[model samples]
Target: MVNITINGKIVQAEEGEMLLSVIRRLKIDVPALCHHEAVEPLGACRLCMVEITKEDWNGWSKFVTSCLYPVEPDLIVLTHSDQVNEIRRTIMDLYLARHPNSPEIQKLAEEYGVLKTSYEVQVDGDNCILCGICTRICDAMGFHAISLVGRGHGKTVAPPLDEPPPDCTGCLSCALNCPTNFIEFSDQGNKRTIWKKDFEMLACVKCGATTITREFAEFLSRNRDIPFEYFETCDACHRKETSLSMGRIAAWTKEAQS
Candidate 1:
């Protein structure tokens, strides 16, 4: 366990635990995006920056991303100091400049009192804040289906070549992990398309229910050596079938006694 002072209150945190996790544990108010507990911290949003003063420092404090920074002994942290609030407002302004119409961005702007931005708004019908959460989660899933492309003014997240790559398995992890809801999805009949890549849907043989994407099923079967018979039944039908089989065995045992 490590002891650190957060907003002048001493708190105990597990060794090597992230500062953001500790801050959240302390119930300290801190705004953050591009942070998911299940996925590794990217620290791309910079909205969770906190001012920290080292024990040996000569009254000098430095700002660091709370999501990636770990707790240590004798560390003095400020969650919402003047410096921290200033930095957060500036970062939110930059995000608003790029995504003016986003409710999430606008909400944060309202909270931080950021009414306007000096930077020129880039109007390209894009609402992505470029937090990279979608791309990071996709890479973590081992699909590497989507990623942030280009640089500077041209930087944007998209599939490779701005078209769906064959590597995408239609996992929908990217769309699910997207904080800004930038990823689009379309489902029509047996086909489901996301990012311009269409995937066939697998249906349960018994219930005729759409089970999952054919690409996802194939990927799982190929990687885990799962049998085709397992995919033939959907989750609900499989549970029902298992219950019925168990009941039949119990009935046979009762009949044998008679």
Candidate 2:
């Protein structure tokens, strides 16, 4: 454990843990767009920048991204100092210029008092901020389907060869984890389509309701060692079965006691 001071409050945090995690645990509002607990921290979004210093550093301090900076003993962190807020405001201003159409970006920028960007707005720009959260989450799921292609302003997340990803099972991990909601997919009846690839949706045998994609269920069953038949039922039916089984057990116990 390491003792750290945040906003004049001394707190104990696990050594080597990221400062952003500690700040969040303390209920401090630090806006971070590219961070997800399911994957390793990528300091792509500079919104979580904070000022830090140590008593032995001769009063000199430096700004660091909290999501990637690990906590150290006697570390002094200022999450919303004047310099930190200025940095965040600048980043938000740029974001507003680049993603003017994105509601998420607009709301966050408004919080930082960036109602209008000083830079020229890209009116035709897509909402993608290029934070790489979607690509990172897709990679963490063990499917190298989508990736950031090109360089500089031309960079974008796309399937391999600019075609439908063969390895994608319509898992929706990339689309769901995207902070900007840039990825789009559609579901119609028993058909699910994402990345221009169509997948057959799995239907519950007991309730006839749609569940996940069949390919995802099979992948889970094969890799996670779960029974394939378990995916045949939807979550509601499974809960119903579990309740019935528990009720029967209780009745059996009562009868035996009598």
Candidate 3:
């Protein structure tokens, strides 16, 4: 057992615990995006960076992502700091721009004293946040159906070949595990959304949200090999995608040229 000061309060934690995990275990509630309890620490999101001081280490820790940092004996940890807040705010802004209307992001922003950003992505009450929490959590379930695809600004959750991951086993673990309803699923931990086809599903085009039959998505990918992770069509715009695909087919006869 090692004793350390956190936020100026002395606290005792295990010798080799990750700083982030130790903080959460102590009920510190640090903000997290890429950190998960089940998977190897990826540290991609860089959300849980912390400020620390200790006998072994002094000065700021810079932006060391807490999700991957090992705790040091006698270390003083500050989970929240003005610098941390600024970086976190910027991260939230980027997420908002991409997803725009994710309730989870919105809630996080509100908690950090950031009510709005200079740019707000269009909010249609049905936007997928694309935060990656669901995908990360899916690792815990051993079902890798949904995942982050592409790179940088163009990244998104996808299956395989942009098609649904075949080994999905129809588990909607992603949706049930998602902090935001960006992905589709029926029951939590049910391996059905990753499999099946020909489902009666309803989607919201603006937000790309699914209102019914998330399992149907698996049908398209697992059965047809089409990347059907995103919304096919909302109940209101079901014909739009089809019409666009089919184009304008008018049957006005050949006029009266005859």
Candidate 4:
């Protein structure tokens, strides 16, 4: 256990844990977004910036992303210093200028006491707030069906050229992974047939058996597109994999054969 001092108080942490994890473990005050232990830590938001001062270190330091920053023995960290707070507030303001209707960003701004920004609030047709959390999650989870496109102020998260992304398994992983709730699956989408709601990713199981409200086989057949060969398995498939590797696939097979 390393005795890391946060604002002069010694706190202990195990190896490989981040400073944000350490602070949370110590019940210290820190701010964060897009920081979930269950998912990979991407330092995109820069909202969890902290001021870290070590024993051997000189001068105050600003850290943009605490989720990825590590804490070591004898480490000294200051979570909320004047400089870090100002930068965070500025970032928040810029985000607000772009997305005034975003509840998530507004709540964070309120926490930091950011009243408002001088820049005009622009509204895009899409529900995305451009946090990059959704796209990042898809990539981290090995579902590279979507991406952020364009550049500078014109960036948008979507499939390339607004075409139906081939990698999409109708899993609703994009909708599930999104932060702003931008995508709403429905029976209607003009880009392609697979964009329809009935073709969305259906959950079954990890095993190659079972039926549910949405099945990959059904989706794949309807879309006339099956980019990946091994899109089998349902949520409950993992638990029953050891036994009966094959089951009353007879019913489905007959149905399939017909």
Candidate 5:
């Protein structure tokens, strides 16, 4: 166990666990962007910066990304110091400058007391902050479909050349995990469109609900080398169907009587 002092309170934490875990476990209010429990932390937003003072260090405390920093014994951490707050404000302001109209970024700016930034706003680009959560989640899901395109300020989230690759299964994981709502998907007829790729959806036989993408279903089956015939059924319809089929002899007798 690692013993650390967070905001002057002593806490015991596991070694190598992220400092954000300790801070969150202590119930300290810290804003997080580009962070989700299911996905790996990228620390791209820099919103979780906190002041840290090592036990043996003589220099001034330094700011670090709490989500990426590992917990260490005898470490002293401050989550909401003036320096930490200023860094958070600056980060939020920069994000706001890039995405002034985004409600999510606007809310964070308002919460962090940053009404606006002196930097010029680029209007022609999308509101994505380049946090890479979408790309990371897609990679984690084993589909290297979407990615951060271009370089520096010119970068944006999309599949290569704004066109989805053949490997894309339209799983929608990227759109689902995006923090800035920069990704969009649509379903029309039997086609689901995302990342400039269209996928055929498997409709549930009983309820006609679109269950999953045909490409994604095929990927899962082929990757796992398993046959799962029920993938075409949505959960609700599947449950209803399984319940009806539970007792075939009784169902036959009931149907005959009816």
Candidate 6:
């Protein structure tokens, strides 16, 4: 365990743990858009930047992204210092300029007191903040189906050759995990569409409701050692069955005791 001072409060944190995790553990309201526990921290979004210094630094403090900075003994962290707030506001201003249409960005910027961007706004811009969360989640799901393609302004998340990803199982991990909700997918009855690809969804045998794509079920069965029949029922129906079985077990136990 390492002891560190956060906002003038001494707190103990695990050595080598990221500062953002510790800050979150303390229930500090730090805004971080590109952070997800499922993947490694990329520090793509600079919103979680905090001022850090040590007593031996001669009163000099440096700004660092909390998501990437690890906890060290006697480390001092200022999560909401004046300089840190200004830096976050500047970054939010740029985000508003780039993603003017994104409600998420707008709301966050407003909270940071960045009502209007000083830079020119991209009115036709998509909601994608390019935080890379979607792509990272896709890779974490073992599907490497999409990635940031091109460079600079031309960069975007897309499949190979801008075509439907052949490896995508329509599992919706990328879409669901996206911080900005940029990825779009539609479900209609037993059909699912995403990234211009169509997939056949599995219907629950008990409730006749759509559950997951057949491809995802098959993949989980093959790789995770789960039986494919497990996906035959929806989650709600599975819970119901579990409750009934537990009730029967309790009754059997009571009768045996008597």
Q: Best by lDDT, which number?
A: 6
- Residue runs of model 2 more than 4 Å from their true location after superposition: none
State the TM-score for model 6: 0.94
Best by TM-score: 2
lDDT of 4 by residue, 1-258 (tens): 778777678777886788888888877767666666667787877877877766556664556477888766777787877888898899888878877777777787888898786577776634466667767766765657678899876788877567777666565555656655566665332121333334533334443343322444555555667643334555455446634445556667888999
Error of 1 at 127 (Å): 1.2
Per-residue lDDT value at 159 in model 1: 84
Candidate 6: lDDT of 217? 95
TM-scores of all candidate predictions against the true structure: 0.89, 0.96, 0.64, 0.68, 0.89, 0.94
Pairs of colliding residues, candidate 1? none
20-111, model 1: which lDDT tens digit per residue? Answer: 99998878779887998878888989999999997799999999999999888889999999989999999988888888888878888889
How would you encode candidate 5's per-residue C-alpha lDDT over 54-162 as one tens digit per residue?
8779866888999999888899999999888988988887887778888888888898899987689867757788888888888888888878788976777777777
Ranking by lDDT: 6, 2, 1, 5, 4, 3
Expressed as tens digits, the lDDT of each residue in 1-258 for candidate 3 is: 888777888878777778888788878888886666766777766678887665645464666777787877777777788887888888877767666667787898888876777675655434555557767766655566667788865677777676646556544556666666556554422223332322344446465555545554665566668776444556556566667655533323334343
Stretches of candidate 1 off by over 4 Å are 252-258
Candidate 1 vs candidate 4, lDDT winner: 1
- Which stretch of 10 consecutive residues in model 3 shows the poorest summed lDDT? 189-198
Candidate 2 per-residue lDDT, tens place, 1-258, comes to 879999999999999999999999999999999999999998999999999999999989999999999999999999999999999999999998899998988899889898999999887899888889888888888887889999998988899888999889898988888888899999899999999999999999988888899999998999899999999999999999999999999999999999
lDDT against the true structure, per candidate, is 0.87, 0.93, 0.66, 0.66, 0.84, 0.94
- The RMSD (Cα, Å) of candidate 4 is 8.7
| Runs with alpha carbons beyond 4 Å of true place in candidate 3 | 55-61, 120-132, 137-140, 186-258
RMSD, each candidate, Å?
2.3, 1.3, 17.7, 8.7, 3.5, 1.6
Look at candidate 5 and tell me the lDDT of residue 15: 91
Query: lDDT score of model 5?
Result: 0.84
